[model samples]
Target: MEETRPAPADLRGYCGNCFGLCCVALPFARSADFAFDKPAGTPCRNLLADHTCGIHTELRRRGFAGCTVYDCLGAGQKVSQVVFEGRDGGRRMHEVFPVVRQLHELLTYLTEALALPAARPVHAELREALDRTDALTRGTPEELTALDVGAHRQAVARLLFEASELTRAKVRGRKKRHRGADLMGARLKGADLRGADLRGAYLIAADLTGADLRSADLIGADLRDADLGGADLTGALFLTQPQVDAARGNAGTRLPGSVGRPVHWAAGG
Candidate 1:
């Protein structure tokens, strides 16, 4: 039997081990998500010297909701410790960080796909892709910076698409195809979205209360401010914690075992 891969703890960020890469490397404007304008390579004012967010607990309250929802997919710690050996490489570290982040995201999807019983048909291929992607993440900074991430992403997406099809095929009846659809602020309350292809769809501020999103492919779908109260999202495909955090939900909302309910949900998010 193949060795059981460890749980996806490595796929999730452990900020305590990270070097404040996200706070310094990424750029954000003064949008509704962020409180101020920050340029690339510049550290956020709230990032402490110890590499922890000074306003972490009050990010949402301080108009920094974007920071609260940003998950590095474990790339921050990996780059800090594994890639740079815990030494802040400054510019080089910043450059390699985003590249590894993309790879980690693909790894996250592949690992999740392999765990699904419905995706057994593509298990071999998925395992191979996972191994290859993980290897890429371990490459040197120069190698990572020079890598063709878009091509790799396209290749991984094909496998994820196959895994999604197999899982959704288990759901009988007609399924919706809304890949990359613009559904912002739409009234979709009580919608039957089971097995729907919602990839890259703009769902901002949409009313999804009591909607059935089982087996729906939500990869890259924007859920910012989307109401998920009482929604059934058990078995939702490719759903990330960041997406859940960005959306508004309540205690009645059902979720997959892979993701936990956001704290704000308890307060009627």
Candidate 2:
């Protein structure tokens, strides 16, 4: 099959060319997010032979809500169709997947950083990092498994922080600093959160209608059911698919280029 290259920010899980790596390679602990514990290296019972999920449509109803938050950032296809092209699934396939998954996640952010107009000062560095990361993704499975991902992440992280500062600096007025705050169910409507250091903040069910979140570092922030109506999230750092999927947003909410509009947003969920 011909590989149709998608835009960098549009990277997503293409399960067709994947061997259901997310279902098998990653372990799931039994919790509200997941109904039952699933060990790593074991395929879920719902995974079909053709690499499709049998209970895909009824995942939430069947207590597999954790699957909805996952986004491989196109790593699954890269692993299945590139690294292990001539080989079949084995212990190696499962082992290398986690590493590649992290690499692709970084790529997702780096790709968006390149597209940010305010982040132009670091575009060259971002491009260099992107190239290096892309090269690493194409490395052999052994190399991927052995990669120093922590070191690479630290290097790229500085560039991303610089880019965030550049973008958030454009926002007028004082910026809010809510880093790691327990703001659960807090009403922050129309608040100015530009360049806010909200990393690891607990925003579960918070009301942020029409809030300005530009360039806020949302790494590890819990946004479950947070109202984001008309909020501006352009250049928001470390925002992920799962966070967006869990949040409440309408057509008016502006998101970063890296993520797509959640299906639930369109259906008026």
Candidate 3:
């Protein structure tokens, strides 16, 4: 796969080279989002042998709603092609599986950074970091085949932390408190919301649909529309997958976990 230029705001734009790793590397519980429980590193039931979703057209119908919300941030393909150099699956790279997963996780953070409004001031810095990481995806086969991906991921994680701090400072309220506040119709789409304490916040109709909510505390947040479709909420605290599945979103909507498409809203109703 040819390496393409990274866009300033589109995160999925980086995933062209991904090998659909998120579908295979993560775990999901049987709930409104998933018809059956699947453990980590195990192939999803809906995943075809060729790395495509077998029920791509019926994710919601099959009860794997969470699968519709995930994006790998292009790390899948980078790892597969650059790191593994077109290596086949079902081989003895089991020792390096963890490294691949970590890299994918880093890619998720980079993707979220590109979506944040607060990060705009430092977009150049973020873009540079992304490019460097992107370059890491083009190492020689020997370098890719024998790299300490864990260390590389940690360095990237540090850069992500710096970017996150810059972005989060913009969202943190002056008083650092927003309990039971009404934020409906708020234009918070694609905001950097990592670790925000949004407990019981009235977020109805708020356009936070594409916000990066990694590790955010959403204990009792009211989320409807606010377009979580395509948002990354991985590791978001106190947010149950069922709550996300029950919420309204279309195929274009993103979620915290899983890479399946949204359930047809009309049919679900």
Candidate 4:
């Protein structure tokens, strides 16, 4: 039996200072998951001028199931309040847009690092990084508004990669390095499997409803009944849209490869 990881407390709500960057910085495809396609750096069609989703109440009805599953790790508010210093929505969005997007990506990586079991032993280190990132978010308007964010994000990303490798080493049988392992009915729900090599792993009935599989190599992994209901698999490799549909998922699941969400979920048939 695989040990399960505990769910992390919701930390996004405490970050009200964001400008809703994720909705703007990220892109979406028109499919069962989203009502329309949005390009990176362009505001989502459903995004109001105020940076809020226009169809917030009807995301599922509108087919944007993917949009509903994303979390910004509080970086959205931090970038808006600290980096942009509460700039009006009408200001030079083009100038600061790239910075906000980069910061959001960095936050996504850091958040994944914090959830890995390998990082558990070094959680204090991860927490310290989080604190520093948080502090950067609260920096003076001048400091936050600058454009040297790439360097900062790269530095943190290196640490996260190291932590992920360390944690993945602890899982049993995973060390065999199979290109694809059979893992049916494994009960790995809510496991912290960041950066693990799951290339082509058979995960039928694995119950990975809310597992943190960020940056993990899942090339060709079978996902029947995997239950990714609330899981974040951003940057996870080799995942296909067909694999997602074959599995059980709800509105809260986030996936990779820009696959459209399943429409049957909305009809509840």
Q: Which model scores highest in TM-score?
A: 1
Tens-place lDDT per residue, model 3, 1-269, is 34344542322323345445666667778876578888877777667767777787777567765665544444566566656777755423333444544544454456556666655766666666666665655565445557778677667656655655565465445323355778877788788776676757888777766777775656557764445655777755445433464456655554454333434554442
- For candidate 2, give the lDDT: 0.84
Candidate 1: residue pairs that collide: none
lDDT of 2 by residue, 1-269 (tens): 33223376336888877888998899999987688888999988888988799998887778876788677888888888888984655789999888888888788778767777999999888888988988888889889989999999999988987887787788777778787899999999998888898878999999999998887879778998899999999878879888998888999999987678887687663
Which residue runs of candidate 4 sit more than 4 Å off their true CA positions? Answer: 1-20, 23-26, 39-45, 49-51, 89-128, 139-151, 174-195, 198-247, 250-269
Better of 2 and 3 by lDDT: 2
Model 4 lDDT vs. the true structure?
A: 0.62
RMSD of each: 1.1, 3.7, 8.9, 9.4
Model 4, span 1-269: residue lDDT tens: 33222122323422345565666667778876677788877777666766677888787677876655554544555556655567754334434544554554454446666666656776666666766665565555456567478688667756765675676565454433434777888877788777677756898778887888876766457775567778888766435445666677777777774456766545431
Predicted model with the maximum lDDT: 1
